[model samples]
Target: MAGEEGKIDPMHQFEIQPIFDGGFEIAGQTINFTNSALWMILTFITLWIFMLGGMKREIIPGRWQVMVESMSNFVTNMLTSNVGEAGRKYVPYVFSLFMFILFANILGMLPIGVIGLHPFTVTSHIAITGILAVLSFSIVLIVGFWKHGLHFFSLFVPHGTPLPMVPFIAVIEFISFMIRPFSLGLRLFVAMTAGHVLLKVLGGFVINSTNAGAGYGALVGIPSFMLMVGISALELLVAVIQAYVFALLTSLYINDAENLH
Candidate 1:
């Protein structure tokens, strides 16, 4: 009867279990081997490989070096265009964030079984995204105060506003700034989670339909497979786009700190 309802346990695909057991009242935290960890490791490896491949100094750049150079140039241009020359110094921070997110998103699209026969989905985990958001926000807050000192408070109050309006505007601005981290983090987390879930549902439907009857199953399976492929490609693009957006926003925040504008 339950099967007739076409309901499947979505959480079953993502179980977070402990990696190891501790002895003698140690009670170590349960470190579930999740898809998030897999993709995180993949992201690190991807970054390592890219850095290693491009580390050599050569007058005539190899293809790998050229690729890295192009990406660096791209991020540089993005920062320069958005935040001007002074923003160049922040390029490394932005690039690191971009690469981490790009790899994370891309890694999540791969088959869950690829790494360790575990169903891992990096996007499904909110804590990871929250940490990224917190880091960016921390940078903005700390750097703003460091660069501008108490003058950073001016950000909440427009330069020419009346005294009465200043309080209202300042309060609103403070609230908005406070929410920025949560919004940015949630945006990436939600988008990836929804995309993956949609793909999973479609894939499941195809599988279930195929099991029921051959002719009908073939009709559904072909489109389902194509949809999954299309979605996967789209996810790749989204991964890069989200990374760029996050970096761009971070640069903008930093620029505001530097210029107090």
Candidate 2:
């Protein structure tokens, strides 16, 4: 989504434009359905189709079923390793979270832009990722208090601390704990946004150079196209890794809540 009268506007892709003519007002705010929301809905539908493939549990699994099962097992293993048997109860939630993010990231990287289609990366927006991070953190808080009550605050205090250092350490840990959701969300937002911007900029180079002249195209356009291809591959890798990191960290945080470690 870079071309605008032969000029490139990389950030144009991230803009949230209303798809509907009007929106219902809540309080003083009018919330309109946007392209971002549309893409999110599309991502959900795509994910549903993908999961539906694995729904039929034949005696011998098909390739689609195996692929889905492999992703499920991957997330389940991640949860189990991070949180032990306690994590088993959380497999469904964490797996859904991981798959949604993975799909959203991959959907944004689709090359359909060449066909005049714009794909939005939901996770590129801090608001969306922040909500997800807050949700995960909320679960941790709920589980911690539900199980440990006042003892849950002890999470800020590590074991075997001397009395003098306890107060200072708890303050630092409290600050750190409070920052978790913000940091978690910012990490994903920055990664996705930065990657898309870089790709768009390089794509601009490829397009402009190719149109300028054959010599310029040979010198600049081909290299930029090649680099874009490589970065696209890395972006795909990052999409998967970020999803895993989000799920893994959520499971680890839950582990801390469940075990008070």
Candidate 3:
């Protein structure tokens, strides 16, 4: 293993591994704790730390307290501005999603190595992000119908349409609505997975070139190493942007459902 030709398998980093030696099976499905679950728990712990620290009213707040207050205020403002009075009720859920995703994205970028013991980014996986999207959309649907009743159907029908084209327009709207969760989840997954893969590929080039020793390989390797560093910095920005985009889009969707536009 030490003398392997190359170790550039980027997707290998996202593989799931069991924490325990054995897992229980029920109804042909295995229920076992995994690295993903561990990362999720870690995310929750990070969130708890900030929230708990923020709860302490201090004349001068610490960094963690400031972060907690700043993010809480940010999400609160986003919700109220986007979704209005009704958005206040959903602050907890929105805040939780934002912090959890923000923590997951930032932590995943840490140099934890390709080991099971290290933390991973759960948002990079489609299954996790898709589930979140579905849950949010489910709330949108339930709230839409609960608030508007039979008139909820109005969401499918445009403001003004010719009589004969109503069915076609309505069908198009329904299809667009159905595609939201998939698009939302896939957007996040693709952004994260692609960024990590690029970083790994560039890193591999640096590693392979440097391993080849002091001549031509080193010439190519040094620039590649520099490029890798640059990309890592870029990835950090992408991570924050992706997390914010997810939360912002979720708020916008809530607004669309509540206001029917």
Q: CA lDDT, every prediction?
A: 0.77, 0.92, 0.85
| Candidate 2 TM-score to native | 0.95
Cα displacement (angstroms), candidate 3, residue 44, comes to 1.1
Tens digits of per-residue lDDT, candidate 1, 49-113, equal 98888888689999999988888898899889877898888899888888888777777676754
Which candidate's TM-score is highest? 2
Candidates 1 and 2 compared by lDDT, better number: 2
Error of 1 at 226 (Å): 2.5
> lDDT by residue for model 3 over 1-261, one digit each (tens)?
113556667676688888887889999989779888889898889778768988877879888779778989999999999999889888898888888888899888988674634557889999999999999899888988888887888888888788899999999999999899998899889998998888877777777777778774678878887888898899899888988888898898888778887
Runs of candidate 3 with Cα error greater than 4 angstroms are: 1-4, 59-63, 114-117, 162-164
Tens-digit lDDT string for candidate 2 (35-88): 889989988999999999999998799999999999999988988888888889
**For every model shown, what is its TM-score relative to the native structure?**
0.86, 0.95, 0.91
lDDT of 2 at 21: 90
C-alpha lDDT of candidate 2 relative to the true structure:
0.92
- Residues forming the 10-long window of minimal summed lDDT in candidate 1: 17-26
State the TM-score for model 1.
0.86
Instruction: Record all residue pairs in model 2 with backbone atoms less than 3 Å apart, i.e. clashing.
Output: none
